[model samples]
Target: MADDKKVLDDGELVLVKDYVEEIITDLKYSTEDNFTLKVIYNYSDAYLRYGTVKKLKKAQEIFKKKGYRIKIWDAYRTVEAQRFMWEIYPDDDFVADPNIGFSNHNRGTAVDVTLVDEAGNELKMPTGFDDFEAVMNYDPEDEKNKERTENASMLNEIMTSCGFRRSTTEWWHFNDTDKYPVVEGFNSII
Candidate 1:
């Protein structure tokens, strides 16, 4: 991980694993298993702005005390990647339009995450990653949705308290607002 330690400290974009230990990364865009059914990202690593990394480090410390950790699904997307994703999903509520406003992820200030137990298994949430249903909203009121909602509520409480904004539709998405840079090419920063 020497190269990781060297190249990953870019002030504009740094891999989350550099500061957040044991943070599992599931780069959805780097595989065919995603909504696109094709690889989007050329590489697989959760990269965010350095400032975001420091904020996440704080969040991880808090989660660690609670016997939980963050598992990341995706982070640091290029506009080209977003365009390809839009071609497949095309839902503005979920996929941001590359032609218009930039995605928070493109800014290296956003992350898609879920809480995991000490054993490293993700806690049960309202829906799995990429689930766009209304029930996937952070908290649902139905008794059947209690565990899921409570789990999401817990994530919301932790991330928000740590300075990350929760997404209204995707329970797993969060943004570190103060350090947003909004970019078009993921490699441009490198």
Candidate 2:
């Protein structure tokens, strides 16, 4: 039990565990609708929970004061749900490659989010989060896709500046310092 880290309880569709306070501050976080699905999709038996709710609230307060807000693309996706995504986009590099050993979602310490205006309007990203294309991942020099590239770059800068790292593939995805040891069986959190 680290003083700054805490296990997340499944109270909502998303499963986000709290991390070190500095880690939370550095992550520039948000939870989107899909992020919620990430948490409980595999373990339907487990209750829903969103780990970053508190951090998000705090971050939102600051962003809102600046006339900006957060938007989400996906949240707490279960390993099973990720598998489904792998099946649907087998060749898609934007998401985790199933052949890869693990994913942040499986560890319950990651989230997908973007920025929005005070009105809650999301700015565009390099590509739609789930879009199955190299261009959607993080190709910064694709002159043909300037809009998406710029969007992805901006989002990545914000998230990374806060201490989150960007996946070479998906710009909206990020991980927290607190990583789960193993994928727990879906249990009733709520």
TM-score of each: 0.88, 0.60
Which residue pairs show collisions in model 1?
none
lDDT score for residue 168 of model 1: 76
Taking the tens digit of each residue's C-alpha lDDT, what string does model 2 give over 1-190? 1233545453333422332221121121122223223332433221113444444445555566667665644445556666765765566455566466556765655666677775656666665545545444555676877876676666566555554566666676776544454355644263
Q: Which stretches of candidate 1 lie over 4 Å from their true place?
A: 1-11, 134-139, 188-190
lDDT for each residue of candidate 1 in 79-142, tens digit (9 for 90 to 100): 7888888888888989898888878888888899998998888898988888776444444767
Model 2: CA > 4 A from native: 1-62, 97-100, 134-150
Residue 125 deviation, candidate 1, in Å?
A: 0.2
Instruction: Supply candidate 2's per-residue lDDT for 65.
Output: 62
**Predicted model with the maximum TM-score:** 1
